[model samples]
Target: MIVDAWFTVQQIDEATYAISEYGHWEKVHSFLLLGTKKAALIDTGLGIDSIKRITNQLTDLPITVLTTHVHSDHIGSHGEFDSLCVHEAEEDWLISGIKGLSIDIIRKNIGRDITLPTPASFNPETFTPFQGKPTGLLKDGGEIELGERTLTIIHTPGHSPGHICLFDKSTGYLFTGDLLYDETPVYAFYPTTNPADLVASWERISSLKGIYKIYGSHNTLGLEPSLLNEVKIAVRYLRENDLAKFGTGIHRFSGFSVQF
Candidate 1:
């Protein structure tokens, strides 16, 4: 374990680590997976502080940031990395910023709710999400090889048109992004969200085989693979009752909930 004033670094395994910001309301998590030849960083955390300060001490290997989506909270520290990869569907959003999301709202969300001392550099009033060109674009079924550890990209839209989940085949670890997580409801009611695609994505990930553990972008650090079964039941229930749409409110399940 590596202790810091801001980021909480937990080693998931010999080659993987979860870089988390627990002081913020969102409790964002960014993963670091090291391989023989290179490394992969999954979604940088809220840019309240420069995440690069922490990552620099973690590994010496070159890192390629794999964005889960283009949301402000998830891609906050994207500007710190040299190589960035985002889904093809959101190339414009990554380069030019999301069209409808207001910076005031973003400032409000990132500025509020804090339990730890923030860096002096973090001024919520002037805080801005990173925006630039992606080094590459990700697509469904794409494989990112980090030496012996290969990651499979699952295009699980609904949370956002470009929301994706990463699967580490060797470890059976599924990083579900915002598409699935416990506690606060997974949101899909925004103008940019698609509820139908969200439920379909739930159904798709629920059927994945050999998922030993599941990791979401928020809340609890990791989840049991059995949670996927509950997702299957939730998916069926949502479809059976036609509740997967905007203004449907919140649908609670055994371990998680989704808002449409």
Candidate 2:
């Protein structure tokens, strides 16, 4: 394990790591998957600290960032990396900041509920999300080959238009991003979110062939693959009851929950 003031690095395997920030309310987690040729960084943590500093110490392989979405918290340190890839649907947002979202609101959220001392380099008042052209755009069923290991991208939109889940073929690790996670309600209530799409995404992931472990971007680090069974049930119930719509409030299931 690697220790740091802002990020907690946990080794999932000899070549995989989970870099988490527990000091923040969101409890955001980023994953580093190393392959024989290169490494893929799932997402960057909150911009309060530079994640590159930690990545530098982890591996010598050239890093390519795999963006699950274009949300602020997830792409906070996107500028720190050179080769960045995002879903084709969110390519515009990566080039230009997400529209309709006010900087004031974003700043407020980033500055609140912080339990650790942030570096002086971060100024919440001036905080702004990264906006730049992506080096590559990914699509559904896309395969990212990192030498010996290969990751398949599943387009699981809902919480965001381009939200995606990465499935590592070698490890059976499914990185669900914000589409699934525990401890906090998966958000789909915002104007940009789609309740119907979220449920559909849940159903899509539930049907995946072999998922030995489930890893989300927030809250709890890793969830049991059995939770996908609960997700299937939740999706069926939500659709049958016509509850997949805006303002339906929070729907709680056995191991996870969603808001819309």
Q: Rate the local accuracy (lDDT) of all candidates.
A: 0.93, 0.94
* Model 2, span 19-40: residue lDDT tens: 9999999999999999999999
What value does the lDDT take at residue 68 in candidate 1? 97
**Model 1 stretches astray by more than 4 angstroms:** none
User: Which tens-of-lDDT digit does each residue in 1-260 have in candidate 1?
Assistant: 57799999999999899999999999888899998889999999998888888888889999999999999888989999999999999999999998978999999999999999999999999998888999999999999999999999999999999999999999999999899989999999999999999999999999999999899999999999999889999988999999999999998999999989
lDDT of 1 at 204: 95
lDDT of residue 130 for candidate 2: 93
lDDT of 1: 0.93
Q: Which residue runs of candidate 2 sit more than 4 Å off their true CA positions?
A: none
Pairs that collide, model 1: none
The collision pairs in model 2 are: none
